[model samples]
Target: MSSSSSHPDLILTNARITSMSSSPLPSNSDAIAVTHGRVSSIGPTSAIATLAGPSTKRIDARGRSVVPGLVDAHNHGVKACLARLYACSFTFSASPQDIEAALEGFFERNSGVECVMGGRYGSEFFKTYAGQLLPTPREWLDARSRGRAVYLREESGHNGWANSRALELVGITRESVDPKGGRIGRTDAGELTGVLIEDADVQARLRWPDWTAAQYEDAVREYVKVANGFGIVGSTDADANEGILKALSEVDREGGLSLHVVAAQTTPYGHREEPLDYGLHERWRELYTSDHVDASFVKIYLDGVARDDSRTAFLLEQYLPDPRFPESHRSHAHVPAETLARDYVELDRRGFTVKTHCCGDGSVRATLDAIQAAREANPARSEIELLRHEVAHCMLVSASDIPRFRRLNAVAELSPYLWSGESCVSHRRACLGSERVERWYPVKELLDAGTELAAGSDWPAAVASVNPWPGLASLVTRTDTSDPSSAPIGLDQAVSIEDALRIFTVQGARAIKRGKDTGSIEVGKSADFVVLDRDVMEVDPRMVGATKVDVTVFEGRIVYEREGAN
Candidate 1:
């Protein structure tokens, strides 16, 4: 316990600081002291004032509410940023003409570019407009694309639409076989229909030109700038890669990266029915540490999405059979059960924390079962806290798997941003049927079961914006932020505002193995916090997402300040 004057670097006074800690101090404090990028003291305004030295800067919070900076427990910053900067995307509500107009405008501007790519058209495009433009042929795309390859990733990121030239670039022909666990849409006469799913999409990406490392760095810088404006201090890059790592390291070294990041190397999955080589750890072993980067975690996608329009997600029960393929309607996992469990045991034995994308009940159970197997096979390492594995997008967890999360100490990385959105609900009902739709996201159940839970935006992939505020609000309101009049997705699963904030803060930090360093604004913890435009607790819960961030402080530095907030 050093006196504030001995090390004070900055002080914030006349503030309502919600420390998010269980300490005995007042919940709303008047002041806080920061030294060496960490909190040193917190108490009455006068108490903090007495310890401030002449060199210490002081910020007058003007009674604004301050809490630990928010974290996106799971995100793909590279993908999200690139999607906005380099791709041709339209809003979910945009009509086919709007999409065509955007594409025409894009082609007119970038005539020299070899390929046109970007997407996320909603289910309406597939369900209602399929006859008009969806099963669109190469001729339609070629007319607008000027012979350049055209690939549009669906909102789910698991499926794509490609023109004939783009398909030809990937060498897909009528004679081509659908990659195992993936599909290539074809007509009843067996002609290619230009739609690719699962592994098929991966093939397209592999053939597509890569973004230069410098471009990735620029995109990340832009993303961080946007995130800073939203009061985000850190995030977990769910789909980390060599290019992403290089970009983050460059920005961090240049003093441009304001957000702390835990980068997870994407794990290997099935390719054409055979598991890809399992030496990711060996190949990436040297990248285990870097400034603003943690490469110890690995990411895995257990299955794709399972909605009415996209039945690619692995499931415990069969989906209502498609008329085209009635007997094989249920989605399948990316990896076989035995192989997944074996890989889990191997990764656990080697001391790597893994996070898997689990959109359906079958995938969630499979992920948990793998962890349980790892625990059983590696008894010597069972108690290691650093081994806390994670499961992302627990979209449709089974009632039985709810307890397994607690028993296995698994972290549930939820994207409540989609929890109450209209498009999300429609997908559930159409793909999962009416009865199963009621079991959508089970956040409250997980929390009530004593399972650790954290929130994320899954940005660029979801149909909503990347800001976590709307997601936080959805956790409490369980209704659409865009249209509050819409029905709640699952009001029974809603959490309190305070608990929602905690999920975005403290719990998020714990999920990334940084609990002791930040999360809560306590003595000896990193001084990462946000000053809101209003007292979130006092505002209408439905309006929480609209609340602005007045100031964002990371590592004791004022990184972002709203122009008129002061």
Candidate 2:
């Protein structure tokens, strides 16, 4: 064994380590040595064993597969943790009775919580009860709320539902005018229906009871625990506010953070009538940045979701008109093109990586155009230093705009949680028509065009959890394991497992501007990797979602160990 000073802190022996490096390790390199929170050496078990001192901790993998720790390119980590820990929690498929029961149970269990928040009921809930005279959404919620403020988010996260008490508390009423980029639902009689869309939801949420600083810190800690259990060592918080960033900074400062966090600070969205506060990003960067937290990314929402009933996604082509929206109505952008371009230019000048939410082709094109505008505005910037802005949720991009991503050095951030032939896909199919729906997630095309594709779960929105396994599986299979009988969505767009893995790992690191540090399990990189219960590379692709992490190691330390796993 080597001297204590030269010895590795930890070692893993008899393991199948998939380094995920461009240059593969030698075939005989089955063991790994970690020193001072980074990969120190990689070689055969006999050779690596020689570097371990008397005090070195060693884990016998017993031939299990180990790969780079996963990265969720985009997710609302704090919000997802809050939802998992304290919300009423029900799925979109839950019936009215089921939702009511969930609310009842939540209220019964926690008598002191001032606001009852949860949800994710589908838009079908509104369509099903649109004209009903008795038990309107407000009335239904009112009955269940016990007079407390009740707020439930829609499945898309772009809309919300509130009881009468919540509506009153938020001061949204029949007299309330729709915000420039949002709408308030009302009955034919001009009574509020408790359905808040886009900016309206934002307005209500801004006024709702928010978590305190301590709660935010707790949420961050919980988020890390859940993410580590799922083998996530890095993630981008898609919409971080001051509170979220502060919590992340505090946790990291206290040595509580186990994963790398790239926080995209929130910007104005959906016609709240507020200008983008460019100074806030600079202030946050100075105040909240830590070793594990990067507050240099910004999130901008260009448009809303593409659900059939919402029809809020800004599309180049008009949606198939429904009874509510008759004439030529392709949804409009939240910010004007000129304004978006200006914002992009300023953000680029400030060296912030912008991630714009664009669900429809129109929004996607607008975002790309803005990126081009930024590039034109900054001609002197070198390619190496140019910030790679991302088009988040590039779900319904136009064919002509596909290659522009590579030309402009932009990332197509795909949320695989929304790629399956699930209820949301069906809703999109109805709103977008057959042709567009068939070409839904153009993953292969984007990759083939040389556009860097990054994967995200978009948890607490379309997905039940932040488990990247299911999303990774969906990227290759284009099918949901939960609904095996459903048809594949964009089957031709399915990429290889190798490509999908890269999207989740290396591409994610690139998106977060940490490609050289931690994405792969190469020597000298952060010793962040997961020991899997099965070899995902060799598993049946359909069964990949079931692949579980036996243990998760972060920065040379074990952060999570599944119970009963050896």
Number of backbone collisions per candidate:
1, 0
Candidate 2: RMSD to truth: 2.1
TM-scores for all candidates: the values are 0.93, 0.96
Per-residue accuracy of model 1 over 1-566 as CA lDDT, tens digit each: 45445848889999988888867566546899999889989988888888888889888898888889989888877777877788787776666687789888787777777877878776556566666664454455566676778888777677788889999989999999988867898888897888887788887787888888877998889889888888898899888777887788778888888887888887554432444345766467455466677777788888888667667778899888677555757777888788788878888777778899988889899899999999888877535454888988888888988999888888988978886457767777876786776657788899899989988888777645678898899888887776868777767888899999989999998887778887889999999998998888889998897979988999999999999889
Local distance difference test, candidate 1: 0.81
- The model with the greatest lDDT is 2
How many clashing pairs does model 2 include?
0
The TM-score between candidate 1 and the true structure equals 0.93
RMSD of each: 2.7, 2.1
Off by over 4 Å in 2: 1-4, 128-133, 272-275
Which candidate tops TM-score?
Answer: 2
- Which regions of candidate 1 deviate over 4 angstroms? 1-7, 26-28, 53-55, 108-111, 134-137, 269-278, 382-384
Model 2, range 308-412, lDDT digits (tens) per residue? 777888999999878878688899888888888988999899999999999899999999999999999997889789899999998888999999999999999
lDDT of each: 0.81, 0.88
What would you estimate as the lDDT of candidate 2? Answer: 0.88
